[model samples]
Target: MSSKRDLIIQAAKQTFLKQGFEATSMDELALVANVARRTIYNQFDSKEELFNAVIIDIWKNVKPYRPEQNDEAQHNPSKGLFNLGMAIANYWSPPIVRSFLKLVIVEGDRFPDLPRNFYRLGKEPMIQSIFDYLTQMKHSHLLKIDDIGLATQQFIGMINEPLIGLGLIILSDEPDMQRKEHVVQAAVQCFINGYQP
Candidate 1:
């Protein structure tokens, strides 16, 4: 069975996704969660805290990278980068993430921490992971990257633009797997062409 906290977070995710942060009320959350209003206060001090918890919950789908343990990254930079790009593309191309991003854009002025926490917890770590992977590749003499940070950002930008940015701003449907593959492959190819020793 689900714990009360889990139930509350789940309810909050659905509610916040539907009604957004400003419009959602603790009383409605309690009712939706099938718990008392006090139960919510017991679990989360305020609605903002609960909303942050929902963001954290949503980010749980993002798997962290440990470059040291990744043989593919160590031995094969092209394959590894393509794999990483695909992972990033798949994660951010969904409707839930798109909706959450829209919510952040809408409410970031009122709750500044929303976008900060979103990037800090989600994008920063992923970027850092890619940075570390690039550092590893450079050290191993697999790739000749002079600036790992810029390369990491460039690689990520390449994948994120078509997969996430287009859909978030103008496109309505998610890019198909073939499109994702093409984007990642092109990113890896361009990165390798630029950085290969």
Candidate 2:
């Protein structure tokens, strides 16, 4: 990501956060980005294109990955599961993640295609990550999953159960540690109940 692109996405996020997706215009983005109107068009062809870019940028940043734990997990499988719970909990609790999610949910109906695109780019990666982790656990003989897909669903359900309500946006009430720890512990416990060998 170029610095300019980052600037544009940040500006878009601010614009979307303030004015929302429907009201935000390219001119507003340009003003916020401190670039010329033509500069915005040069980077993005249209408002819809700019929205897609901003949405992708946000999803990519919050994407879950386990590069740090992968090598260690080659020897210790349990650590991978623990790391995943922590990552998922932390990923969801971030203010930016919550903002993007709220934007998508709120504006999803106006742009019918947006929900599909966001689901593909955002949630699919998390599901695939959990599937891979479960596969590794099966391979390590630490867990026995009759069906990886179903197990993945269980993992996601546990992680997301608490976030199903609208209260996901109300972040100031709880300490960050407590919020994430509760999610992490719930996720790990549920996963183990279904996956323990």
Candidate 3:
């Protein structure tokens, strides 16, 4: 059984995904959620608040890096980096994420905080995780990186360029997995080669 809050959130996501944030109304949300209008307000103060909750909920679904899984990767830089690239690719390639991103792009001007909030909620933490992983790799003497931040950006760019810059923007279908793997593997190999002692 779902809580009232959870049910409302799920319904809101579906409604927003289908009709977008700007067009979705509280009444529509109540109807879809099968809850009273007051119940919706009791959980979320406003539509903007509910939309932010939806973004946070989506971000929560994307897996974050686990520090406990670091030991094996620390011993092998190539393996570690390939795994990291794949994780990033996997996170960004989801249909729900793509839909959310499109919504952000479309609604960002109207709600100035939307894009920033989405980045803070989703991309920022993932970037920090990769940065920390790179730092750990450096400390372990697995790789020699002059600037962790730049290296992190470059590695992420490499993974994102094709998947998002090309695939998502142009294609209607999910970005091809083989292409994603190729890009990730190539990026990892290039990164390893550049950082080798």
Tens digits of per-residue lDDT, candidate 1, 66-109, equal: 55677766799887887788878877865777788888888999
Better of 1 and 3 by TM-score: 1
The backbone clash count of each candidate, in order, is: 0, 0, 0
Residue 135 lDDT in model 3? 93
Scored against the true structure, residue 86 in model 1 reaches a CA lDDT of 82
Candidate 2 per-residue C-alpha lDDT over 36-99 given as tens digits, one digit per residue, 9 for 90 to 100: 9998888888877787787787777676766345788655555676677666666666566677
Model 1 earns a TM-score of: 0.90
- Residues 1-197, model 3: lDDT tens digits: 99999999999999998998889999999999999999999999999899889888888878766543877776887877888798888887667887888788888999878888889888888888889988988998888988999999999998888777755565456667797789899999889888887
lDDT of 3: 0.85
- Regarding lDDT, does 1 or 2 come out ahead? 1
Error of 1 at 119 (Å): 1.6
Candidate 1: the clashing residue pairs are: none
Clashing residue pairs in candidate 2 (N, C-alpha, C atoms within 3 angstroms)? none
The candidate maximizing TM-score is: 1
